[model samples]
Target: MAEPSTARTLTTEPRRTPPAPRSVGAYPLLAWTWMRAMAQYPVSLLLLTFGQAASTGLELTALFFVFGHAHQLAGFGINEALLIYGLAGVAFCLADFFMGSVERLGEHVRKGSFDTMLVRPVSPLVQLATDEFSPRRLGKVVPAVAALCYALAVLDIDWTPARILMLPVLIVSSIVICCCVWTLGASIQFFIADAREVANSVTYGGQAMTEYPLAIYGRSVVRTATFVVPLAFASWQPALFLLDRPDPTGLPEWLRYAAPGVALLMSLAATLAWRTGLRHYRSTGS
Candidate 1:
């Protein structure tokens, strides 16, 4: 999936980078520094924030128009579909906001800043993950939370104890899965350049998949989203549980409860992939 056109020239020989720093404080400091840097530019902040929300809004608007004609999608009313969109948006936006720095790994690798990360006494992964935390991204979160709240108000699902408990878990698990997707993509930067398209296709495209009910998708798509890629764990499975809907796949009713576990597994897998990629690094010789 890595395109050579965007890849930087480097030796094929691989070697290990430096060990991580033990200082825990470097992480908070790095995150705070990134926040302050963003604060210096209010206009950029506004644009970035509004731009993300606008993209999600456009998709929602198109869905609205579709509903205006047909009144439902895969048996979901507009508000029900909005619920899926909102939950997915919150999860995706939170990942983009919190772990956005992962997106910059390619640039760091190309510019040799990744070496700087190695020289530091802190963990390179943590440093890179926190390097770009834009508080303005929370602006996008506002509308998403609003949509979710609207869904909760309008959807006829009963809030059982499990549902109430899983609500927060859903948001948390979605965030983790999205970050793992970003980390996996960023890891590709260690092996090749401009993995952005591949990463976006998986991460953002996965979110796009989540914006709709999974009931309409075919068996292959559902399996890919479940066992292979696990997008369903982030949105669809949880939605089914919360909404009291049955799994069309007939896999297992308990699958909905496994969101957090799925996220955890993905995070572990991503970390392993990143570490593997790091070991293969033949630096740019900068």
Candidate 2:
């Protein structure tokens, strides 16, 4: 009878927005985990580190032998040659320590393990590079630093303000160039599963070539290194600026300052190659 029934109001709680996904700390986390695992075996780590140092030390010995045969190589005195060797060694060792593991991409692709990296919420490059990170690789830096110090002390360089600034810039650019080369070489693995040897020939062989005066390799080799791979920027070109020396191959004086730009271009090329390789990758379907 009575039409005064109060209508019940339906109330709904505000929907809470789901929290955003957290950023993945890929490289630091994986690298730390590997470092912890390696720490569990102290003696093995020490021995492996020492072995790495000894192997690189032999390269220095070879340099001394080269100098013993003559006071100058390709018109570069012993000190100048040592400067090149030291700078190249430091750059290569630093690059290898960080990016060397990328070379295993071929093995990962062959075994179908690379597929797992694709599904993770992280860049595969960081994961692959930090995988099984080893402290032993830092061992090579010891001799390289020592050699650099000795060369800097003994070389009669007239260090102007520009040269002083160029020293660190050159070293940093060389490291970037070397790392780019590693990534570029690793990109080849996506197409050629067994191309590790070929990649090594480019990355390691380039390092070997850079560890001395490019002048010793003849004009043809110098030209190839300059225009083809740009390996000359890793040590030769910027080093000439640092030492206030002329390019033995008669490259333009401005080329001495081109290392940083070359490194940037190499970085862009490497990044593009890696992305293209990833797009073309086919899973092993294991």
Clashing pairs in 2: none
Candidate 1, residue 60: Cα displacement in angstroms equals 1.9
RMSD (Å) of each candidate, 1 decimal: 10.4, 7.9
TM-score to true structure, per model: 0.87, 0.91
Per-model C-alpha lDDT, please?
Answer: 0.82, 0.88
How much is 2 displaced in model 1, in angstroms? 56
Q: Please, what are the lDDT tens digits per residue for candidate 1 over residues 1-286?
A: 7798667776788787957556577768888898899889989988988887787678878778978998877777888888887888888878887776787888888888888888777778888878777777777677777888899898998988878888998789988988898899889877878887788898878888887887778677988888988888777887788788888767788888888898889989998998999899777865
Model 2 per-residue lDDT tens digits across residues 1-286: 7655556656698989966534356677888899999999999999999999999899999999999999888889888887888888899899999889999999888887788888776788887888789999999888887888898999888988888888898889989999999999999998998888999997999989998999999999988988888888888886687788888778788987888999999999999999999999987966
What's the TM for model 1?
0.87
**Where is the poorest 10-residue window by lDDT in model 1?**
18-27
